[model samples]
Target: MGIYKPKTYMVMISNVEPSTIHEAMTIPSWNQAVNDELQALIQNHTWDLVPVPTNRSLVGCKWLFKIKKNSDGCVARNKVRLVAQGFFQAARLDYHATFSPVVKANTVHQILTLVVSRKWKLQQVDVNNAFLNGDLA
Candidate 1:
């Protein structure tokens, strides 16, 4: 029998996410990503950049960076978002207790598996910061 050699593999990774706006501004792709985030915020009317009010606590904002990958483990796009710190206010003072539920990864995987097996068309909706649609029981 002929000897079988193991295949040599080396993954080339280039999609490191920038941690700060300054870092993101240096790269063309990251800069475009940041611009996209700003446009979305403005289009959605998420918030207004007004002067800081006197004696009022203002929450800090930061940018979060992520690289979207394709099913073949290839870099598809760069995603950037502005997020609030959300930790300056005390409980019940800012606006009662805060609670937000999100979908889990495993559950998403199962749903995707079933859809793929049944050859169903897939549609996705980004529910980030989605307001309450009904009364919470």
Candidate 2:
């Protein structure tokens, strides 16, 4: 028997899904990395996947990929994400608690006014993938 070197395919954004068509083509290393990430998201409970239940709503997921570019249009990074199509989901059934702090406009205004009066510097910071920090109930 002869040794075989696996053929690779390139992922092209087109009318058909890259995975379905990949059998007839070669997949590039970059595309494989993106695919692997998508798989891990499912395995790691990033989102729960279930079949469409009768008399109930279901959320659909889509694969998203983008190539970050510099000002000169040169490729800098590759980002891949699997996101839910929110339209298919019902608020109470799909997502009941957002866990985001609820602050009224009046409350925000009052806080800002107090901050200004105290001459304190206002600062804002964001945590990346904050949802991942929470434990799954």
Candidate 3:
């Protein structure tokens, strides 16, 4: 018999998520995702362009990049979100109150249990830019 030879395997990794806008703009997928986010914000009238007030502090914003994946570990899409740096604002100086509308896990479980016991039909709705739907003032 001939000398036995072992097979070699190589793994390649790619599609790294960019950490900055400059880096992201260079990639086509990330660039498109950024454009999509801007378009959505504009179409929804999320904010108005206004001159900065001399007395009020201006809040800075940043672009966050994320790669959404499918259940099978395949990349679904490039997601970009523009978020304000709220930490820069002082509590009493910047605004009056802060509130987060979050549902408790126990409440969700109870609702699901009730629905299951009653054999009720359940429909799920996914709202894109749900945060933008809220009124700012």
Identify the candidate with maximal TM-score: 3
How does candidate 1 fare on TM-score? 0.59
Candidate 3 on 10-112: residue-level lDDT in tens?
Answer: 4332268899999998887788888988988889777778888777878788999888776899776777888777787787887543333334455557677
Per residue, candidate 2 scores C-alpha lDDT tens digits across 1-137 of 79999996554432323433243135454466466665666555665545666766555556565555558975554455555566665667757422322234565576678889999998842221212424322
Say which prediction, candidate 2 or candidate 3, comes out ahead on lDDT: 3
- Per-candidate count of clashing residue pairs (backbone under 3 Å): 0, 6, 0
Score each candidate by Cα lDDT. Answer: 0.68, 0.51, 0.72
TM-scores for every predicted model: 0.59, 0.43, 0.66
- TM-score for model 3? 0.66
Candidate 1 weakest lDDT stretch, 10 residues: 128-137
Model 1 lDDT per residue over 1-137, tens place: 89999995654434889888999898888888788778766776665577876656666778898888878988877877676677766765764333333346565577788889999988873544322233332
Best by lDDT: 3
Residue pairs of candidate 1 with colliding backbone atoms: none
Candidate structures ordered by lDDT, highest first: 3, 1, 2
